[model samples]
Target: MNNVRSKICGITRVEDALAAARAGADAIGLVFYAKSPRAVNVQQARAIVQALPPFVTTVGLFVDASRCEVGEILDALPLDLLQFHGDETPAQCEGHGRPWIKALRVRPGDDLEAACQEYVGARALLLDAYVAGVPGGTGQSFDWSLIPARLSKPVVLAGGLSPDNVAEAIAQVKPWAVDVSGGVEQAKGIKDAQKIDAFLRAVRGA
Candidate 1:
């Protein structure tokens, strides 16, 4: 089987970031949105990034934050990628001098292809479950059938992904990558090493 990349999101500590890397995660996401329970400050994010081993990508996740706020975090850390989890315009996502992925919360009757076209500059489109007033990390699964078989850009499957269900999700979606946050967590922001290992194993086995 071909390799499907994995990303462990909502990492708050250096220990968890290192754990994700050890568990063979391709990337570790640091939540920068203040509303999220897993959100991290600049110091915490920097510490996690510094502790990660070689070849593990560091991603900074933001909500609908201002350009200045995003710039401040970018200036402080050596993040490999930026993940915008809110309603950000294409222009805002671009001109940042770093690659970015835009997250779209999937809802019934939504035209994903058209939305993808609007955000044509994104490196990939991350599909998550849509909850009223909730940004992301909802730990809820949406209808996988809503995704089109072909997309102009790559897809990163997320939302309610755990060791038990990830294999099935991979078979169904066949996304370029899979991102998990609450799925491998001991609690809101704390990562469970055992869960992380099991999740990776499931993905690789699939």
Candidate 2:
């Protein structure tokens, strides 16, 4: 089998996006949710996307954003994929006519398998830890065992992942990809270059 891919989300700066691409991140995510401290304006995100090297995927993240909001950003910036991190239905997600990854917050006793089935046609299913009063960007990990081995779609593990434990997470869960936000950040929306390099190295080693 091939090595697990990883994404560095909540990117806010051109330097950070460059660092993430250089560090071998499969994709770099830019938050567009206005409520998020990590959110970036279209111009800022477009600059960062344009600055990246070829083949480095740029991902746009939204939290129940309106169609107009998503359309406006897509029209302005170059994005390879869209990630829906809120209570968006499959129809709403697919209506945009862009490939998308749907994030599902997993909690104890939750049926991950069934949830994946519910979001049919998603490019990938991102499994994030369930935290009270937190929508996303909470660097907390859920039980790997909570995920069933059998699923209809690809699984992308998110929540709390870092250089130290990513290898273990990969070995155990065998997810198609892993995503990190706060784990590689200097602040809520800022990414650390050293941490980004280390995290990518760890994923490669796994």
Best by TM-score: 1
TM-score of every model? 0.99, 0.96
**List of clashing residue pairs for candidate 2:** none
Q: What is the lDDT of residue 115 in candidate 1?
A: 79
CA deviation > 4 Å runs, candidate 1: none
lDDT of 2 by residue, 1-206 (tens): 35788899999999999999988999999999888889999889988988999988888999888889889888888788999999998877887767999998898888767877788878889999998767799899989999888787899999899889988999998999999999998888888999999998888888
Residue 87 error, candidate 2, Å: 0.4
Q: Which structure among the candidates has the greatest lDDT? A: 1
Candidate 2 runs further than 4 Å off: none
